[model samples]
Target: MFSTALQSLSSHLPGCASSGGTSLKANLKHITVTLATWDAVWEVYLDPKWARQQLRLYGAQDRAMEQFFKKLKKEISELSMKRHGRAKQRVLFVGAAGIGTRGDWGGDAVLWACCK
Candidate 1:
């Protein structure tokens, strides 16, 4: 199930200049699977576009990076599962208004909570 979601997200990710870039795809798959376990789905919810962007920006096509992502996913999944129940969890981000501060924080915060 998690793999399927990762694949779906990989396909949806933008800026794939290379057709043979399965490395990024694989990394994304691993991350999503890990997140599924960890309950970090909130991160994705918080900045879905940013998450996708990271995948693209990293452009990792090496085994080392793949392993790193896989390990991270595993750790995150474990931690998230331990902290949060198996059921989906939600997170909310509230911000205060200030002169030099933009309201950008609330959008993703609200998105993350609502997504879960």
Candidate 2:
């Protein structure tokens, strides 16, 4: 039960943005579904206001970003059913971090050369 997440990552992945415009938000539905298949995944957003507005996760309409992600951790740890016949270790830790994705190259590495 997998689906392409093109729409869901509009906020996090920066695909739907055009010409200095904002992108659509679908992180909640996507992350929730993906969590069903994953024990843990890292989501690090530097901007709280932007991330909250973008990650329209279930029950997050009335909660702050901290509350939202804490609930997510809870769901992943206590709720989701593993899709296998055996037990698996699960753990996740979220923290503050920054990355520069505005250009094709940065951070001691060259990801791509969009312009030659």
Candidate 3:
């Protein structure tokens, strides 16, 4: 299940060449998450502010980004399998808010590297 999820994620990323378990990038996009908590279900993509409030109340404040991606990947796979549809849609990653780390894609180099 993890490998399938990783493959699905890799194929959707920009400039990634996947072949039998290579490397991947961890870049993230701005995605809205749908979550149900406390008798209210939220489609948080439309309203960030409301989502934040609800997530905070639901005790997901620390892992909001993780939750977003988890839900997104699952939904993408499910939708594609259920409808026989394509899951290769463009995603917009707004701002540097969700970046896990700082990296350098050298000014004029070929390799991309990130330092932990």
Candidate 4:
């Protein structure tokens, strides 16, 4: 199911060209998945576009990121049922004002160094 959602994202957002001569479609690292045991974890990568149009600094618009959130919820709910009870859960939908190519990191205090 998660794979299906990832596939759909590529369709929704046509990629932009990057300096490395690769398109954003080729850099699907935007979405990250990690595994944990005896606990529930669902991390949905928020599209940069969605954040810009629908999200505010201190709040979110109704259904701002609904589609992805719903899919993650459904998957987590199903997995929780198999354990027969509520579990320690961590659901993260992450985005930034401008982390990728949208803007240079100019406002934040955190120095973000990277590898070439």
Best by TM-score: 4
TM-score, per-candidate, Cα-based = 0.23, 0.20, 0.24, 0.25
Summarize candidate 2's per-residue lDDT along 1-100 as a digit string, tens digits.
2334654444465565563543233545656678775643333344576567655752353245445555655565454455554434454433322353
Report the lDDT of model 1 for residue 86: 53
Give one digit per residue, the lDDT tens place, for model 1 in 1-116.
75677567767766864547568557767776886767565655668798777666545433344465456556666777888855343333345423323323344543433343
lDDT for 67 in candidate 4 is 48
Instruction: Give the per-residue lDDT of model 4 (tens digit) for 1-116.
Output: 76677667657766652236755444444443223321342222355765665446313422333444566666777788778676435444344434433333322311221100
Task: Write candidate 3's Cα lDDT for 1-116 as tens digits.
Answer: 64567668767875665344434333221111222242344344457897677657545533454456556666766887667765554343434333333332222211111110
Model 1: weakest 10-residue lDDT segment is 97-106
Relative to the true structure, candidate 2 reaches a TM of 0.20
User: Count of backbone clashes for each model?
Assistant: 2, 0, 2, 0
Candidate models: Cα lDDT each: 0.55, 0.44, 0.46, 0.45
Per-residue lDDT value at 96 in model 4: 46
Residue pairs of candidate 1 with colliding backbone atoms: 38-77, 38-80
Better of 2 and 4 by lDDT: 4
Q: What is the lDDT of residue 90 in candidate 4?
A: 44
